[model samples]
Target: MAVVLAEILAGLGLLFFGLKTMSSHLQSATGRRVRALLRSATRSPFVGLVSGIAAGAATQSSNAVALICGNLVRGGVFTTRDAIPVVAGGNVGTAALVFVAAFDFRLVVFYLLALVGFGFHFKLDRRPAWKEWLWVALGLTLALLGLDFIKQGPRDLDVALISQALDAGLSPGMGFAIGMAAAALCQSSSTPTILVLALMQARLLGLEDAFFIVLGANLGSGLATLVSSGELEGTGRQLCYVHILVKAIGCAVLLAAWIAVALAGGDPEAALAAAGGSGGAQAAISMLFLALQLAGAVTVALARGLTERIAVRFSPPSMEDDASRPRYIHRRAAEEPATALDLSERESMRLIKLLPNLLPDLDRGGADFSTQERNAFWKGSTAIVQAVDHFLVDVIRAGATRESLDIALRQQARLETVRALVDTLHDFSGVVGEFETVPPLAFNLSESLRVIVLSLAEATDGGTGDDFDLLIGLTADRSEMLDRIRRALAASEAGGEADSRRLMHATSLFERAVWLVRRVAVALRPPPIEDRAQDGDPARQEAPEGVA
Candidate 1:
């Protein structure tokens, strides 16, 4: 009994390891391409469904498709409405795996494929590009091999004893519970479903028992997704909720139908015999699972509006889910410093992007900066800066490589610069808010300041050194104009000494704001390669004559 248990445990471990390895590598290799495809293909629901089917089949995991869709929605590439059909089609694509599993394809074929994959990986010049696919092939081979081992494990034991242990005291509810537990433990419905089919083939479990187990496995797959999506919020959370809800509803509907059939005196065993015994039973089970999934897909697609309403109601946004918080600096991504850095960079860029919106424009004179807008902007910008800082600290603690650390440091520098820019912009907005009371002479200064701000904003928007020299020239021209304004205010007596001082103070604030904006643009600009080799002296590489 102990030996049989050991063999079973080993087989399950291999299966799980293979699945994890395969899914991770597959995601790494194809995630960007899949995202791009989804973005381009999701012009309509039907196209999204086809894209999802292709992506899910290629990756061999519906969860991967869900996650990819979730990311697309989170990134604003797709709406929650668009993602629904893709997720549904992912279910259909996942069913393809079960369908393929029903065949008796020799394990040797997988092994040969893995070998060929490895050979290609080593022989190819693009090893980095092809290595993930090889790992995926190897993982599939190991998973198939693990299934074979699991099937052979109980052969040497007392088949009657094993069968009795599984079925003698097991009610349908108990079978469902067992299957759910197994799938959750494995974090995979396919593994447990295939195992149940193997048990059916060994004559240790009947088709009726397998039916409940398969239902439970489907529910368990959703549970796994729910657990994984715990950290996601807003649209990402909605995607996960949709996945779980659809799966649960489909499984429940099937379970109810099965109960109704049984109550109507339907013989499940007779049905299995007619389907062609054990092999037919496995295929039938796969078909039933596929049908339930397709039914869920059709139901959701037909009522997309209602489905979306339910999803929104269930996964409504929280205060933290608002734009004020760091949207892309996902804590879950901290384990991968490169990903964390990328997310942090995006969040920082978001904060910087808000600068133009937050800046008060006198040219649009009647536009009022409402209290609500100001408060929200202030709160959101503050929260994002703090969140990004905390996230960066976490990334550092996660022990990044030297290259990753350098990237993180650069991101941190950019974050600090953005913070500075925001602070300066806030002060400048306050100055502009008092523009109504300013003397007429300050209008020319105001116009000059506006041009400077616009120019800086454009430079920041470009986000490249390609225009740094141009910005530097503009800044120099503005600085000279700002000096003239200050000298005129100092020399004037028409507005009285107090008005002159106020005008000068406002002008000073604008000058400082322009300088900070220019600094941000310069900081964001990548240094030339020639200067990069200076080893920490890149700052010493001077801009053109106009730039300080």
Candidate 2:
């Protein structure tokens, strides 16, 4: 018992390690491509179904595919609806694992591992692009090898004792319960299903018991996944719902079918006997597992509309979900640096546009956002900034004209300012909201901050020449104004020591916000004709309106 337990532990350790290695590398390699694939899936359910199958087969695990899909959703590349078919197809793809295990390719894993190891030894997998796939291959082979070790480890145990204790007289309900428990604990159906396959092959567990256990494993995996995903919300949670529905639907359908067939006098055991003993039994179980997954995938695919509606009902879209995604920047634009840089700027425009909502108390248009909504907007805006940052990096790497390079370089620098401005404004809003009695000095500073952010948004979004001049004027150095506000706050009879501290802190953030906004405007402000005429000039001349 001890030896068997040790083997199981070893196998599990290797299996999980291989799983992580394979998934992280594969996800890294395929992240953007998967997003593109899901976008295409929006055209039709059939295409979505195909995308899921490819993602699963390429990654070779449903859990990995779910994670890939989840990250894409989090990044705002695609919504959950676009991902459902692909996720369902991934489940169908994992059925291939059952087929592979049925063939008992235990020896093949070592040869594949050897091939990969030698490839590593020869440095054949060292190329920048090829490296991730090499790791993927290694991880995949090791996972299989670990599974093999798990299967073969039980040979030393007393077969009779194991059989009697486990499945010899196991009732269908008990078998199903055991399978559910094991799969729930493992958080995947693959291991439990494969273990049943090993049991059948060893002639220690009967076909009926194995069938129930396999079905139960599917059901258990769904429950475990749903539980684990308790923290995910909005579109992110939709993927979790799709995952559960796939397993739950498949298990329910198959279990019902089995009951109906058994009641109709379909002697499954006799059929296995006629087909030739344990080999046939193993084949039968594998096919059933495939059938179960297929049933789920098909149902989810055909009911795509219904599935989406159900998911949305359970987890409605949040403001952050919409906010986090990039509107204009995408991978395709990378080949055109000018166009990509333009898109990056447009994406950045979204950040400044959201600044008004930060302090509803100060926005000129009179905004009102719940604490939750404000936080969501800020989170989403941050995601967009990060997305634009990544897009700009790709633009720089794709090569460009000197002019485009200048724009890209300036944009990169501006991003730092935008990030700082966003943080400053977020902090400024928190501190400004702390007042029990709003002071005129603090209120004026807060309102001015909102106007600068609003004007900056308009300036970037095709604002006229006059608009640019106004933004540059608005955000110009406020060191003098901040000094005045600081003095006023220090002398005023504020609420208390805490109020005085908050007021002073808000002044500092206000100063930073103005400076950061000015930096953004200066970047947006074109170089003066005096500098442009010098053509050979380094263009280091100060922007008009002292925005330098």
Candidate 3:
């Protein structure tokens, strides 16, 4: 009995591991394409349905599809109403894998496929794309083989002993409990459903029991969405809740149907047996699963507005939902270095958007941001920068790949450049305020200062190469003009000592601001694709000065 239990556990472990491997590889191979399809094709409900189905089928994971849809909604690429249909379609598409697994393929065929996949995976000149597909094939083969082993364990046990141990027999309620437990433990509905089907095929489990188990598995599948929603809020959180609610409703409807049938003195088992035995039962269960998914999809699609309203009523926006705080970066995401880095990049971009507001407009005679506003801006900027810095450090410690580390380093440099620009803005604001008190200057100093300020504003407004180049040229012209004015002021007695002092202070601020803007522009621009390819270590190279 111990040996049999060991075998069952081992087989389950292999099955879960195989499924995880297959799903991850399939996502890696097709994730970008699936995202593109979702973005471009989700214009209407029908289009979203088709795209979601295709994405779920390609990736072999409905949860992955839901997460992608959630991200799209967060990014404003899709509305919650539009994402609902796609998420619904993902449920139907996920059912295809279970249908395929129900077939009783020869064991030798799986072994041969696994062997061939291993060979392809180890090939000297194999492409990365081919390697991903080979891994997926290998994982699928292992899962099928494991399913066979799992069935063999129960068959070896005495039927009488197994029935006696179960206590509740092969009743639907017991099956539902068992199914929900297995699915929750595995974090996958497909694994538990497939296992139940295998047990039924081995004659160790009844058809009616397997049917209820599949229903329970459907309900258990919502746990993944529930856990993921903990990290999200606002529209993203609402979308996840909608997904869970749809699955729960479907489960309730199916359970109610079963209860109603029982209450009417109908023998579901007798009906199932009359259909033909286990084979007919399997087909019926598959059809039922698909039907439930479709019904849920249709119901959700018809009442999307109502679903949104309910979700909002439950998860309204909170005070902590301030735009200044980093939305995506969180401690929960630390384990996923790639996602963490991506979040850091997004938060950095938000910080960059504040640059234009920081630049003082001298033509208007004062700074655009009031003193209180500037202080607030500084506080917000510091928080975002520190958050990104801390997040990057965690990503590095989490063992990010070299490529990802390089990207993080680039972001760090950009943040430094932003800090420098902010400081320069502060100094420029102070100088402008001091000049406001002074008398009118000789040698047209105010006009010259205005031109310099305008040029700096234009350069910092856009981080493009052209903008930086124009800034360099303007600064050079201003530098030469400053020298001429200095010489003229020295030769004449009309210009007072106070005027020369103010001119020197303004000149110092203008030069520093120009230099900071140039640095920021360089940090923002990446090396050309070909240049990066040739260098092979573009991250080590310093950002070129005055390069277009």
**Each prediction's Cα lDDT score?**
0.71, 0.77, 0.66
lDDT value, residue 445 of candidate 2: 82
**Model 1 over residues 208-241: C-alpha lDDT tens digits?**
8888888888888877887766556666678777
Select the stronger candidate by TM-score from 1 and 2.
Answer: 2
Model 2 quality (TM-score)? 0.78
The better-scoring model by lDDT among 2 and 3 is 2
lDDT of 2 by residue, 152-232 (tens): 777777778878887556898988898899988887787788888777777778887887898889888877866666556
Model 3: lowest-lDDT 10 consecutive positions: 316-325
Top lDDT prediction, candidate number: 2
Decoy 1 TM-score against native: 0.62
TM-score of each: 0.62, 0.78, 0.60
- Tens digit per residue, CA lDDT, model 3, 279-324: 5756666666676677676677668789778767866643222333
Q: If ranked by lDDT, best first, what sequence of candidates would result?
A: 2, 1, 3
